[model samples]
Target chain A: MLELKEGVRHPVDFILNGKPARGLAEPRMLLSDFLRQELGCAEIHVGCEHGVCGACTVLIDGIPARSCLTLAVQTAGRTVETVRSLAAEDGALSDLQEAFRRHHALQCGYCTPGILMSAEQFLRERADPSEQEVREMLSGHICRCTGYVGIVEAILETARSRAGAR
Target chain B: MKPKPFTYLRPADINEALQALARIGEDARILAGGQSLLPMMNFRLAQARALIDISRLAPLAYIRKTAGEIEIGAATTQAQLLAWPQLGDATPLLSAALPHVGHFQTRSRGTVCGSIAHSDPASELPLCLATLEGKVVLRSSKGERVLPAAEFQTGMLATARRPDEVVVAVRFPERKQGAGYAFMEMAQRHGDFAICAVAAVVSGKTTRLGVGGVADKPTVREWSGLPNGELDDALNDFAWELGGTDDHHATAAYRRELVRRLGRRAIEEAAKCSS
Candidate 1:
C-alpha cells in the first residue's frame, strides 16, 4: 500500500487537457481545489462543493464527474479535461460554445463552462437529441440565469447543425 | 467545504486493501467511488482518519453473472452497470432505478456497492437491492460473510459492516422469467434525492413492495393473493408502519400519502406486466 500521511502534501501527477500536469496536495484535497488552487486551472468553478452543483464538472478519462466530489489523489494517473479544453488549439470557440453564444444560452457565465463541458460530452454521444433529452442532461447543472430555455435551444440547434454538417 | 485531513492509502489489490483496513480499524473507510463518501466528508458528516483507496483496484471492477444472480464488485461504477448490455433484460428494476440514482456526472464514478455501503435512505440502489432481496458480501482478512439486504442495512446511513471489513461485492437476484418489475419515485428535481421511492415485484399470486426515502432504511413487505381493496388496506397499514417523518423536503402525511398513491401505482403497473 502506498500510504500518504495526514496533513502532508504528496505529489500527484496526471494529464490535464492532454498535457502532463503535476501538483502537490494533501490527501484531503479535493480535485476542484487541486485544479484551481494547486495547478492554476482557474476555469474550473467551485459551486456547491458537495456535488449538488455542476460548476466543478470535468471529464475524467472522458467521463463527466464532479471534481469537487473527487479526491486529488484519485486522479494521480488519470486524464482530466476541464471546460477550458473545449476550445480549439487556436483558441477558437467550439461549435457548441458558439451555439451557446448565438442562442444567448448564458448570462454571468459562471455555469457556462460546466454546461459547455457537459454539452460537448452529450453531443458527442448523441448526434440528434430531443429537446427533452437535452433538458435531462442539463438537469445535472444548475444555471440560475437563462432559466435553461436558451440552453436547451442552443443544444438542440447544435445537434441540428452538426447533423447538417455530416 | 474541505474534508478533514486523513491518511490516504492506495492499495495495489484487494488483499492489501483488506490488510490496510484491518490495521487501520474504525478510523479507516474504504474509498471506492467516493461519490457519496467524498460528499459526506466534505460536509464534515464523516471524518475518517484514513481512507483506503480501492477505486483503482482493477480486480474489483466487475459485474459477474452466476447461475441465479448478478454479482457487482466494489469498484463497478453506476455508469458501467447501466451500460451493461444485459442489465435491462436481466434486472429491469435496476435499469429503471439506476437513472434516478444521480445525474449522469455523478453516476459516471459512483459505484454500485459503494451506494449500498453508504446505505442512504434516499438512494435507489439499496431500495432495489432490498426489493430483490440482494446479498452483500462483507470481506476482511479474517474471512467473508454474506448478509441479506434486510440484515445488511441496519439503519439510516448505517449497515452491519464491521469497521475492519469492506463491502467487497453485492449480489442481486436475476429477474424471474415470469415476474414483473417496476420502480417509481417522486423527487423535487430529476437528480435530487427522492422524497419517496417505491419498487414492486409481482409474480403469480405474490407481490413484493419496497419503499424508501420515507423510512430510516428501505423496507420491503410481501403480500400474497390480495384483492385490490385488500391490497389498498395493506399498503395503508404499511405506510403507517413506516412512520414517515417530516423533513424539510416533505411532510409525514405527504409521504404516507405517496406511499398509498404512488405505491399503488407501482404495484398496479407491475401487476399488469406480470405474466
Candidate 2:
C-alpha cells in the first residue's frame, strides 16, 4: 500500500502524452493542477474546477475523464494523454485538427483542446458514428462559442474522411 | 478551489481497504471513481482526513451475474456496465437510465457503487436501485452485511452505511419474465442534474414507480390494480406525499405535474413492452 501524508509534497510518476513525466503533488492537489503547474503541461485548461466543465478533460489510460475530478496521486504509473498528443510529429495538425480548422469548429479556442481530446478518443472507439451519436458524445463538453454546429460538422467530416481514407 | 489536505492511501486489495477503513473510521472516505467526491472536495463542501482509494483494487472491479441478480463490484465503472453486452437483456432499466447518469466522459470513470454511496437525490442510479429494490453489500474488518436500497439510502446525500463499512458491491435483480422497464428524466442539459426523474417497472398487474429529484430521496410506490382515473389520483397523492419543494431548477408544482405526466408515460411505455 502507498500512503502519502497530508500537507506534504510527494512524487507522482505517470506517462504524459507518451513520455514519462513526474511531478510533486500534495495529497489535496488535483490532476489538472499537477499537470499544468508541476509538469508544465499548459495544454490542460482549468474551467469549473469541478467535474461539470469539460475544459480539464484528458485521457487516462486511453479513456476520457475529467482531470479536475481526479487526484494527482491517482495517476501514479498511469498514462495521461492531453490535447498535445493530437498533433503530428512535425507540428502539422492531425486530420481531425485540420478538419476543425476547415470547418471553423472553434471560436475562442478555450474548449477546443478538451473537445479535441474527447473527439480523438470518440473517433478511435467508433470509426463510423451517426450525427446523433456524435452529438451524444459531444454532450459531455460545453462549447459556448460556434454554437456547436461547426464542431459537429468538423467531427462528422473527420469521420467521413477517415473512413474514405481507410 | 483545491481539496483540503488529507492523507492518500492506495490499498493493495479489498481486504487492505477494509482494514484501513476499520482503522480510520469516520475520518476516512473511500475514493472510488471520484466523480462525485472530488467535486465536493474541490468545492470545500466535504472534508476527509484521509482518502482510501480503491480504484486500483483489481479484485473489486467486476460485474458478475449469478442466478437472477447482477452484482457490480465497487470499482466497476459506469462505462463498463454500459459497454457490457448483457446490459440490455440483463437489466433493461439500467440500460435506459445509465446514459442519463452522466456524459460519456464522466461515465468512463464514475462507478455505479460510488454513485449509490453518494446518494444524490437527483442521481439516476439510486433511483434505478430503488425501483429495482436492489441490495447494497457493505463490508468491514468485522464482517459483512447487506441492506436494501430503500434502507441504505436514508436521505439526500446520506446513507445508512456505517463509517467503518466499505460498500463492496451492489446487487440488482435481473429482468423478470414478462416484465417491462422504462426510465425518463427531465434535465436542463443533457449531462446536467435531473430536475425530475422517474423509473417504472411494470410486471403483470403490479406496477412499481420510483421517483427521484422530487424529494429528499428517491421514493418507490407500487400499485396492484387501479382504473385509469384512480391511478391518476393515486399518482397525484403520491406526488403530494413526496412534498416536492421549489429549487432553482424547478418549481414545486411543476415537478408534481411532471410526476403525474412522466409517470403516466413511463408506465404506459413499460406496459406496452410487457404486453
Candidate 3:
C-alpha cells in the first residue's frame, strides 16, 4: 500500500480564501488528489488524468494549472483556488458565473468548473481580449458538450458587461 | 493509473537537488513540470524508484541576456518563454516554436529543461535547442559541465545527462542582427505531438536546419550560403539521413516525404530572412 500522507512529509502552507492552512503530504501526490482527498474539495474533478484535459484546472497564484499534473508539494507556498471558492459565502455567483448562466455556456456541466476557472484567469489577465484570444486561451480545455459557442459567448458577454459597468 | 510507488524527495535548492539526485542515483527521476512525466507514469511507461522534485528551486527559472548569449533557466515554463520580450529579439525561433507545445495549461507548468531532457523526437523544444546550438548546464555533486545540443541528445527518449546530474539551464547564442528563423510542423490536432517538425535559423550566409519526429534524435544540417538547385538536394540529403520507422501515427515513407516537403518550405521561408 502506498502511503499518501507519510514518509518524508513536505509541509504545504498556502492561503485559500484569505485563510492559511498547512498540510503534510508525499511529494508524489498530485494537487488534484490532495485537494479532493485531503482538503475535501470534491468540486475539483479529475478528468483525463493528464495535462491534456483541463477538467482538473485550478488557479495557482491566479494562473490556471492542471492540478492533476501539478504535484501537491509544488503548491507548498502558493495560493490555490477552485470553482468552489468562486461564489461568495452566501453562494451568490460572481459576474462571470452569472454570465455563464445567462449565455447558456454549460451543457452537462462536467467541463464547466474547469472552463470557469480558465476563463476567470483569462479575464483577469486580459480585461479586453479578442474573440480569437479567448478561443486560443481556452483551447487547453475540452468540452464534449455545447461545442464551445456558449462558453465563448459567456466570456465575451461578461467582458462587455463588466466594461460597461467600469 | 497512479505513479508506481517511489520515494519522493523535495530539495529546497540546486545543491540539495543535486545531492538528492546523487544519493538516489540511477533509480531516481527528476520531476519538473510533471506535464510529461506524470502522463508517462500514469501509463506505466516510466517507473522511477525515487522522484526528485525540483519545482521549489526558484532561481532556475529566469531568462536573461548575458554578453553574447541568452541564458534560460531549465525550469523556465513555456508560457514564461513565450511572454519573454528578449526572445523576440534574441531567439525568435524559440518564440515562434513556443506556442506549438502542448497547450496553455501544459505550457504553464512544462519547463524548457524538462522538455529537453525528455528528448521526445516530436517535441518542439528539443529541435529548437539543437538547431540553435544551445548549451545545457548540468550539475552534479562532482562539479558542473556544459553539453552542446548536438551531443546532449543521444537517441529516442535518451540524453547525455548522467543519473546523478540535474540540468540547471540552457543557453543559446544571440541571433545575428539580420538572421531569420522559421519553425513548421504538422499534426492531426493543433496541440498534438507533431508527425514531422522542422526548424530553421538563417544568419548571414549560413542557414542551420533541424528536423525532428523523423529520426531517433533531432537531425541538424547546415548550408553555407544559398546554392543554386541545392534546395532539392538538401531536402533529399535530410530525407536520406533520417532513418525513421513506421509507427502508429505515420509510416517511414510518409515521414520522409514530410521532411522533404517541410524542409523545402522551411528553407524557402528561412532564405527570406538571410541578408
Task: Write the residue-wise lDDT of candidate 3 on B152-263 in tens digits.
Answer: 9999999999999988888888877888888999887677899999998777778788998888889899888667577787788779888889989999999989988988
Displacement of residue A59 (Cα, Å) in model 2 is 0.6
Q: By DockQ, is 1 or 2 better?
A: 2
Clash totals for all models, in order? 0, 0, 0
Question: For each candidate, what's the DockQ?
Answer: 0.89, 0.90, 0.38
Clashing pairs in 3: none
Alpha-carbon lDDT, every model: 0.93, 0.94, 0.84
Candidate achieving the largest DockQ = 2
TM-score of 3: 0.92
Over the stretch A40-153, how does candidate 2's per-residue lDDT look in tens digits? 889999999988869889999999999999999999999999998988889999999999999999989999999999999999999999999888888989888888899999
Task: State residue A77's C-alpha deviation in candidate 1, in Å.
Answer: 1.5
Show where candidate 2 strays beyond 4 Å: none
Candidate 1 RMSD to the correct structure: 1.0
Lowest summed lDDT over 10 consecutive residues: which window, candidate 1 chain B? Answer: B224-233
Give the better candidate number (1 or 3) by lDDT. 1
TM-score of chain B of each: 0.99, 0.99, 0.96
User: Which tens-of-lDDT digit does each residue in B1-275 have in candidate 1?
Assistant: 89999999999899999998888899999898888999899999999999999988888999999989999999999989999999998899999999898998889899999999999998999999999999999999999999999999999999999988999999999999899999999999997999999999999999999999999999999999888779889999999999989989999999999999999999999988889
Considering every candidate listed, which one attains the maximal lDDT? Answer: 2
Clashes of 2: 0
User: Which is the better candidate, 1 or 3, if ranked by TM-score?
Assistant: 1
What TM-score would each prediction reach against the true structure? 0.98, 0.99, 0.92
lDDT (10s digit) by residue, model 1, range A82-118: 9889889899998888989998999999988788888
Candidate 1, DockQ score (0 to 1): 0.89
